[model samples]
Target: MTVPAPAADGLPTRVRIHEVGARDGLQNEKATVPTEVKAEFVRRLADAGLTTIEATSFVHPKWVPQLADAEALFPQVADLPVDLPVLVPNERGLDRALALGARRVAVFASATESFAKANLNRTVDEALAMFDPVVTRAKADGVQVRGYLSMCFGDPWEGPVPLPQVVRVCRALLDMGCDELSLGDTIGVATPGHVQALLTALNEAGVPTPALGVHFHDTYGQALANTLAALRHGVTTVDASAGGLGGCPYAKSATGNLATEDLVWMLRGLGIDTGVDLGRLVATSAWMADHLGRPSPSRTVRALSHKEQ
Candidate 1:
């Protein structure tokens, strides 16, 4: 394995990698991964130095049966000294997460009416309306909330989402008391310029860079590039999955997320500290790939693990 020499670009000194392998990554699995396996996956991700790992979603089993064991799984890894944010679709999901002592929760929103209807069976504003009390209650309880704005860049149904539309929903989430927002390129259609433009637009809309995180999918192989553009614009937090293990369950065109190993490798090369152990992350994803009976899709994971083989 070759480590790229540290080359400090005009980027943040340290970036936070929000690990989503356990929750978003596994939610699309056709076979139900045992609860114990999911628990171990989260544990290993924490051990690999990912500070914030999304644990599971509280969505109904009818919607995402893969994470039906959120109750059984949360307590299993709750003691770990890390941020285990769970996804809560509505007030009901928030209740389930708070019951298990989850301190951080995220609400999934869409930037387009098409995705809003397809995923949540509501209009864009209606979905945000549903999350209004959920965010309010979570903030009232002192729980940190993250607003995940999916289809921020492009929608499979409505191609090329408008920037103002994205900024509007983002401001609504922030005004509604979300601690931060994760802008999701749900279909992986964003380019570097699009990423920068959106960030600038968000900043002009009074959504500070610190309050934003970028979640890019690799369906178009542009996640890393888009991330670089964000970093150059003073955004530090990035959302990725170990071994690149995730896709939108509602959007069939969506593909695996930006791989944690791939993101770490780029950040490490650029002399950006992420507090992640690339070796352990690759190993963890490899272990999970074995569990799923498939090869990991992450290029860096494959490259590093192949050298060991």
Candidate 2:
């Protein structure tokens, strides 16, 4: 598929893509992926020229046994060229990540109350409150924090989330000194119009858009389109997973995130430099999918591999 091109005004023709396959991608798998494979996944991602990769989550073993080896995995690839970030749900998670010498950590919150309670077991306010100490401690230790706000679009239980709620949560995270805020389409219910509306609202509310990133799932196959909408509004950062490895554990019907290979293909075609090699990235995705005993969800990877054959 031919990707679109950006404008020619020399307006900084590069974008930042955060690879989340390690944490969000593998967290929901039924089969357990060994620690060695996870380490190789991070190594291959860095080799693909990805500078930022979410390596694992520091959640409790009972919560996500897939990443229970966070300590083991962090040390295995701690010296990689890319920035390996781990998700820290609370202060305890933060402590675990810090103990492993994690340089960057991500905290998550939802815009709707139902998702907050179901996913994080807290209300929006409560979730933010819980992160206060975590963020405070991480900053004190010189650890960078990236805040994630899920269900930025519509929700399954509650369709069509209020724009004001999204703005409120994003502003709160920014106020809390989050280095960046990633707007997530958790259930993949967002459209380009919704992306524009929310971004505009945040921009009008004096929230810094530059520090904002977009995370879209392809449940409805609109992830790339929504990404375009974000780019048009000057959102330079995007979150994607190799081979589309992640699915929301809370939402049964949700699919994996936008495929990193596909996103890179589109960006390269659009004259936007992502610093990622599409061929190597597809190979990496195929390897991981084979290891997990499942076909990849990345359309670009399948097509590219078939064409090469």
Candidate 3:
């Protein structure tokens, strides 16, 4: 296969999308998904050629009741042909993940104090401090760690988060031994200009775009536009959900992450290779949407489903 190089505009001809439908997507759902269904969801995603599938979170049931079955779900998808990273909020969550033999885990940190307090019940610095030990022990266990920095662009409580604050948190996470950073537009308020400006600032701050993954929410219908900006900056990793499946519980105004199928559609149009089969992916999302008892928010899935008539 001839790998295409970057375009004249500098967008890479290939991108690796991090699939977050199982953990991040289902976590926000009010109705509880059966443990078996959740496992099957992860299986379908891996079968669709998703290289990195976030299987489940080891968060407390009281906090996220939907993913309370993380321990149960992880065992089922652990052997898939992909990197199955589970979310670990603290030391305890990490313990559960490690005991289940998780080879890769994710720790989430917030850029804004309000989101930190709301989601983690700790101040920004306090939360990072809490994650420090988790990262440390995960390292000892030889588990790959992916750091998620939420509210990188905007926060519902604070609104319009500054770049420096985001940079500080991101740098701190990298300093704490996070293998990669996933910058999240939690409230989905970022435009392409904002995305570009932030990536530029992060690059200037010593964090390369290669180590950063752009996670956008399509709330304002800017997910694709902002994603183009990230691509133009040479970003390779993107966090997208199957069927556009989730929203932030803490950020009530937040919507779902960029749909994986939608991202693939744009990348393929730009002649970018994602190694994901768009038709199989859409069918997966459509099937998932049916299970959730709602039509998918993904335009690609909707358009294809409409055409099947």
Candidate 4:
């Protein structure tokens, strides 16, 4: 696939692709991947030049059985030359990550009430409140915190999420010491116009574009287009999973994330730097697809891998 050249003005010259295949990608898989495979996936993602890789979630095994081996999986990739940030659902999870010498962590909250209760068993406000102490304690220990706000565009239970509600959640996360906020289109219902509008609202609400990351799901095949709109709006960080690996178990409409290989292909063609090697990324995703007993979902990987990926 070819991407049009980015306009000489307005678009960012560089973008950061936060690889999440190791964590978000596998978290919802029905089969429990071996810890070794999870570790190798992280290693391969880092080798593909993804500086920020979400290694694993520190949630309880009963909640996400796929990531049950988080403790073991993290150590296998700890010494890699990359920033590995694990997801800490609460204070206890934070303690577990800190015990393993984790330098960066992420906390998640939903922008809608239903998802908040379903995913975290709390109200929207209660969910944000749950993260406050976790964010504060992590920051005090010099650990970088990335806050995630899900259902930014559409919700499974509640139709369209209010723009102000999303902005308020984002602002609260920023104000509570999150180093970065990842806006999640959890249902993959966002379009370019919606992305631009939300970013505009965020800027108007005092959130720095630089401190934001866009997490898009490709359920409607619009993740890349939405991402382009975000780039034009000055959002430099994008969240992607290798081979389009991930979906929200709570939001059935949502599917895999934007594939890293696809994003890298577009970025390279646009003359934007991501510091990632497209060939290596495709190879890694193909390997992961092989492990999952299927072909990679990435169009670029399918085209270039040449082995029926």
The lDDT for every candidate, in the order shown, is: 0.95, 0.90, 0.90, 0.91
Residue 223 in candidate 4, Cα distance off native in Å: 0.4
Question: In candidate 4, what residue range of length 10 has the lowest lDDT sum?
Answer: 1-10
By lDDT, rank the candidates, best first. 1, 4, 2, 3
lDDT value, residue 280 of candidate 1 = 92
Clashes of 2: 1
Per-residue lDDT of model 1, residues 1-309, tens digit only: 445556466789899999998989999999999999999999999999999999999999999999999999999999999999999999999999999999999999999999999999999999999999999999999999999999999999999999999999999999999999999999999999999999999999999999999999998899999999999999989999999998998889999999999999898888888999899999999999999999999999999999998
| Segments of candidate 1 deviating more than 4 angstroms | 1-7
In candidate 4, what are the lDDT values of residues 1-309, reduced to their tens digit?
Answer: 465476457778889999988899999888888888888888888888899999999999899999989888888999999999999999999999999999999999888899999999999899888999999999999999999999999998999998999999999999999999999999999999999999999999999999999999998999999999999989999999999999888888888999998898888788788999787888888888889998888888999988544
lDDT for residue 257 in candidate 3, whole number 0-100: 87
- Residue 88 in candidate 2 has what lDDT? 96
**Which structure among the candidates has the greatest lDDT?**
1
What digit string (tens of lDDT, one per residue) describes model 3 on residues 173-284? 9999999999999999999999989999999999988899999999999999999988888899999999899989888888888999888888877778889978789899
Residue ranges of candidate 2 with Cα displaced over 4 Å:
1-12
lDDT of 2 by residue, 1-309 (tens): 565577445334889999999999999899889999999999999998999999999988998998889988899999997899899999999988888889999999899999999998888899999998888888999999999999899888998899999999999998888999999999998999999999999999988789999999999999999998889888899999999888899987798899999888888877888888887889999999889987898989999878988
Write down the RMSD of all candidates, one decimal each: 1.0, 1.6, 2.3, 1.6
Q: Give me the displacement of residue 153 in model 3, in angstroms.
A: 1.0
What is the RMSD of candidate 3?
Answer: 2.3
